[model samples]
Target: MSISITMIIFSVLFLVFIIRLIKTATFTLEYSLMWLAIGTIMLVFSIFPQIPEYFANLFGFETMSNFLLVMAVLFSLLQLIIFTKYTTKQTDDIKSLIQEVSILKEKVKKEE
Candidate 1:
């Protein structure tokens, strides 16, 4: 149950990141790459954690290696949240600027 919920959350975020990448192809290609890498890495390890243990020990928790796994999931979640907020704010600012331009154009036409 919990695993399904987690998968759903990750899937939604992965979709959003892909959509954003397509929307802003050039400027964000690099940024999108990093997010994709993080998401892919997390998902892979979440499914098969021994892969990370083989590479390097991210943590030395007493019993549950799940400690490191949880931390990685959390870090990925934080990155996604930050990216989403940033993209939302960027869109809002662009809309505001376009509105301001239209208002200025209207004022210039009235002056003429």
Candidate 2:
């Protein structure tokens, strides 16, 4: 019924979900690893239950919720950065493939 117990339960469930996704190839190892790490960190925090509060005090946050909100935002920004990198790489790969196919088509035309 306590917050720490609830957190531990949720973390365990999330970890299981991530593992299932990895096993089913729904998520790449890279993505799964991030989720796994997050889950593990949540589990650790649930066990300690006050580390975040300590850090929040150290950082002069008005409240624990404010600290958590800032942490969530930072985590989201990092995830966005990672997805952007992946999208850029995919775009470049598609461009390269298109160019290669076009060159092959040109060679075929010349041969014919």
Candidate 3:
């Protein structure tokens, strides 16, 4: 109904897509599983009448629709932030690992 609501619904769908992508992508098992769980949980919670009702009315067709959209947007943003952080950490780790390997190679060459 409203812009925020539309955004939220779109966002939720986006999160689900991200989860699937993660599963297929080269990310580690733990990371992929974690994202999948997070996406599913968010989707389930949003659909569950009792949960959404606690904070605000979720039964009205237009209202619920709008609310859902907003929720989706918030969830998507949160996931993105988390994903970015994980990527940054992973990148740094790879760099560190590369350095370690280079040092090991040099050490092996010297001892030979």
Candidate 4:
């Protein structure tokens, strides 16, 4: 019923979901590791509710929620950048593969 208890439950469920994804090969280890780390951090914070409050005060935030929100936003931005880099690399690799296949097809045609 309390926020901390809810967070703890959510964190556990998230960890389980991530593990299942990894087991089923739906998510690669590299991607799952970030999620796993996030879940672990969430669990830790939920277990010790004062940790975030202490950090918020240390960082001069007006409230712990604001501090958490800022952190979540930063994490989301970092994830976006990483995924963008991966997408660009995959596109380039696909283009290279297509070019290679086209060249091979032309060679086969000439041989035939």
lDDT of 2 at 71: 96
Which number leads on lDDT?
4
- For candidate 4, give the lDDT of residue 86: 96
Colliding residue pairs in candidate 3? 8-69, 8-73, 9-69
RMSD of each: 7.0, 1.1, 6.8, 1.0
Cα deviation at 60, candidate 4, in Å, is 1.4
Model 2, poorest ten-residue lDDT window?
44-53
- Tell me how candidate 1 scores on lDDT: 0.73
Residue-by-residue lDDT tens digits, candidate 4, 1-112 = 9988999999999999989998999988888888899899999999998999999999999999999999999999998999999999999999999999999999999999
Name the regions of candidate 2 deviating beyond 4 angstroms. Answer: none
Model 4, TM vs. native = 0.95
- TM-score of model 3 (CA atoms): 0.54
- Report lDDT (CA) for all predictions: 0.73, 0.91, 0.73, 0.94
Q: Which is the better candidate, 2 or 3, if ranked by lDDT?
A: 2
Task: Give the TM-score ranking, best first.
Answer: 4, 2, 3, 1
Better of 3 and 4 by TM-score: 4
What local lDDT score does residue 73 receive in model 2, on the 0 to 100 scale?
100
| Tens-place lDDT digits, model 1, residues 53-95 | 7555446554345666676788889888988999999999999
TM-score of predicted structure 2: 0.92
Q: Largest TM-score belongs to which candidate?
A: 4
TM-score computed on alpha carbons, candidate 1: 0.43
